[model samples]
Target: MRQEDIWDADTAARYDTPGTGMFAPDVVGPAVDRLAALAGGGRALEFAIGTGRVAVPLAARGVPVTGIELSQAMLQRLREKADEAAIPVVVGDMATATAPGEYTLVYLVYNTISNLLTQAEQVACFRNAARHLAPGGRFVIELEVPDLRRLPPGQPAVVFAAEPGYLGVDTFDVLQQHLVSHHFTFDPLITGDRQARVGRSPHRYIWPAELDLMGQLAGFDLESRHADWRGTEFTADSPGHVSVYRTAGKPVSSGP
Candidate 1:
């Protein structure tokens, strides 16, 4: 399946349907708060804002948030939620989207960076974010720690079941640093009973050190790193990785 198809309207509408909000509150909310504090009460940009889960709450806290999203369906859901809660958003691709003005804080939350399938696209995302940030502004990213070492040698697929009857089978192409997960639903009636709901999301997982290199390439300095939203110590065993980067005076011409 194509990358664009995974986040299209139909998929976006089902984003928060069931068994998906676990990470949103515990992981995403506090991270956004930290990013907002870094912004020092100025305007902020949320890359890949889906359904306004984090954006709406952040806006309710009195922070004016401008969201950039590629899926019209996701943006539509976001707009509906925003209208109910009164927030604003911008619809576009995150790797290349340009906002109206420089922001004090630019953030890509919920492992959204992995949505970009290649290193070049991910680097472009950092560069584009730098372009939208004012001098001294911060760019925050939240992602899951890639567990490449856990994969058994010669095994190409790993099964991840978030719950009974709902499975995500992940296939990795190590040479390309690309991974795709097929979401399978056990219930066939809603989806023909015998057939599963298949959705593929392509991702490129980068380590904290690699992300730091990307930040340096984008003319940003690593400000802080955290294990979770509550500012826990970041260690090798941490489940989540949070990194805050400060936009330096200028942009870097090259690197990856």
Candidate 2:
């Protein structure tokens, strides 16, 4: 299924897991800290700003913010958190939608880039971000590295997470660079007992190196890359990364 279709009323409702790894203070603190510093006291934009998980707090940090999102259900949740004036959002595809004005920083966080199911769309996303950014502005992305090494020689699927209440697995189509993450969750919604829920989202996973090439194609230069928001070194074992790509034609400060 398409990425846009994956985020419906149901998914949007539960997107922000308050106590989960994403929303915890430690995780949120570092991410906002890094992004705000990159914003450089100017306007910021978010691609696929679902539920305002990071946008809300970043705006609270005194940066004017805008967003482009395809899912109205997700936008509805964001609206509940912040007024439209505080965070203006365009309801359209991130790969093509244009938010009002230019920004100093444009960020797609938490593996959102994978949402675009094709390489062409992903490249367009880079160009779209470049168009919205002011000269010298930066484009930031937080994404997970594909875990294909875990797949046995002939296997194209792997179950990464299995627990008492949840199960998560990923299947890969190496030839097409496509992946689908499957999730099964248990909750007690009725009868005060366990209720089973299932979800899946398809993605075209791009490698870190390929992503850099995409940035270059969109007139960007790689500024920095880290294993996390805290700027840890990205080593072989790192599962995800935070990358910053500055527009090449303009002079941007390469600093911490």
Candidate 3:
């Protein structure tokens, strides 16, 4: 399926929960703080900057921010929060789209890179980030470590999250390095019935080592990797990681 169809208007409309989930202050604050520091008074480019979640806050924190997003629905939501002057965005696939100017920091947060769904595309994304960065600039990615360990011997599915109103399951196609996340949200109806809303999106899960190789091919060197946006040490047992890659050699100009 096309990526845009997956993140349609309905999904964009309910994407942000101001003070909860991924939008929680504690969740967003550290990320903004880290990205802002990475920007170091220079510009930042965010891949798949949905609803201005990080870009808006990062921009407000005095960091110049630009975005490349494939979903017009998502970009529309971001536009509602900030005008073009505040945060300019290019509407196209993050893997190939070019946003003018070199950036000190390029970031893809919240496992958004996995949305590429193919090794080639994921590799191209790293190259794209490199193309937009200034010398010594860093490209940061927030991604989940594959949860194959949680899947039983022959099982292809695992439950990643189970909360009051939400249930998230990931089914893997190990052969293809592909996985589809299924989300089911329960809402209570006035008639004492619970309405269920379901959504699914495909992703290509990449091992840290594999991701490092991709970065290397894109002329990047792994600088640091942490458990989360807080900069905690990453361990084998960690469920996810935030990796930083510094570009090697000179920057590749992204023409206007």
Candidate 4:
């Protein structure tokens, strides 16, 4: 089945785990603030802007925002929150979709780049972001580095989360550089708890340096990379990075 189909209406309706996980106010605030500052009074575009988790608030902050999303169900949820005029969106692949205007900022958050599933596709996504960028505009990405270091040799999978009625795990295909994440959530014990809910998403994991090369191939220069939206320094131990790449010209302002 197509990956987009996995996010059907049933899944999209509950996609927002607000005030928890990535949707928490503390998490969303810093990312929007950083993105807004980088936009510098110019427009911003989002790739796979799922459920307007970041777009709506960023738009509320007065920056024009547009999006390209593959899942119609996800787009429906976004539209329910904000009118089309407030946050215009294109319904298509992020690697190939086009909105009507050039933008100062284009970003993919929550490691969404991995959803492309191939090196060439990921590179195409970079070129696509560059395509929408005005000269001197910036492209930003929030991505998690592969957690292979923690995977014991000969082990093909790792469990990252385990709690009351919830479990999350990732299985790796080392030869193909692919990973599939499995999420399982069970109903409360009081509800008989027989029917379990589950979902899986596959991705092509990539390295930070590899992405820099992709950026270069797409006419962007590496500008900044931080461990988080709060500007923490990235290190060998950092599990993720928020990277900014700029078109080969002076931007309206220094992008974070």
Candidates, ranked, lDDT: 4, 3, 2, 1
- What would the per-residue lDDT of candidate 3 be over residues 1-256, giving only the tens digit for each residue? 7799999999999898999989999999999988888787788999999899999999999989999998999999999999999999999999999999989899999999999988999999999999998898889999999989888988899998999888999999999999999998887752135568889999999999999999999999998999998889999899999999988765333311
Worst 10 residues of 4 by lDDT: 187-196
What ranking of all candidate models by TM-score puts the best one first? Answer: 4, 2, 3, 1
Roughly what TM-score does model 4 have, to 2 decimal places?
0.96
Highest lDDT against the true fold, candidate: 4
- Write down the worst ten-residue block by lDDT for model 1: 247-256
Residue-wise C-alpha lDDT for candidate 1, range 147-202, written one tens digit per residue: 77767899988886678669878898888877887898877657875777777888
List per-prediction Cα lDDT, in the order shown. Answer: 0.79, 0.90, 0.90, 0.92
User: Candidate 1 at residue 104, lDDT?
Assistant: 81
Residues 55-160 of candidate 2: C-alpha lDDT, one tens digit per residue: 9999999988899899999999999999799999999999999998778899999999998988999999999999998889999999999888899998888999
Error of 4 at 60 (Å): 0.5
- How high is each candidate's TM-score? 0.89, 0.95, 0.94, 0.96
RMSD (Cα, Å) for all candidates, in order, is 4.4, 1.7, 3.5, 1.5
User: Between 3 and 4, whose lDDT is larger?
Assistant: 4
Residues 126-220 of candidate 4: C-alpha lDDT, one tens digit per residue: 99999998889999999998899978899999998999888999999989889999988887663355876788889899999999999999999
Model 4 score (lDDT): 0.92
